[model samples]
Target: MAELIGPRLYSCCNCRNHVSFHDDIISKAFQGKNGRAFLFSHAMNVVTGPKEDRTLLTGLHTVADVYCGDCREVLGWKYERAYEPSQKYKEGKFILEKSKIVKENW
Candidate 1:
């Protein structure tokens, strides 16, 4: 993909306090309500508090929730394998591990 002109912030779905962006993309991450709205929703965090692993999310134990730095909104989540306690995944990382995006305002 071509490089975007601004910073980009990506969040995790399972854990509400976690958020990330390339050290190089911090500024562009704060675009607006349209681009950063998902960062503040439970749909992204999965649960407001601790959540027991569901059978459907099968094998997903460790959940990392994330949000935006500027508005402190929900952005996404990252799910870790129940068997493997590591960060590396074969198919690349899955950000926003379980949340759904209802709108694309941002």
Candidate 2:
């Protein structure tokens, strides 16, 4: 039988970009049209592109594409600014595409 793991870490599939640590995960397996993704309250070694207004999602005042720090591959997006203050917590958070990431042990 497969042992049950508490949780899994994720990295960019193409270049194995380590974005967040275990404690940084806000949510896992977020489903979308693209695919399942991991939501992190914090991420590291990510660069954001120019912020576009009212483009990606409604009420998302400013959003930008996030890239891997090493390979420059599109990994996820960073929400810089949002219309609601309550949503401001997600300003620096990331929604990394599962399809672009690989689950890692430890």
Q: Please, what are the lDDT tens digits per residue for candidate 1 over residues 1-106?
A: 9655543433433333334333312122222223332222222223332334422223445544434443444544334334444422311222332232321212
lDDT per model vs. reference: 0.34, 0.74
Q: After superposition, how far is residue 34 of candidate 1 from its true place, in Å?
A: 15
Give the CA lDDT, 0 to 100, for residue 6 in model 1: 43
Model 2 lDDT per residue over 5-104, tens place: 6655677778886776777778775643377777788878778888887544445558788888889888878777878876677677788887877767
Off by over 4 Å in 2: 1-8, 29-33, 55-58
Candidate 2 backbone overlaps, count: 0
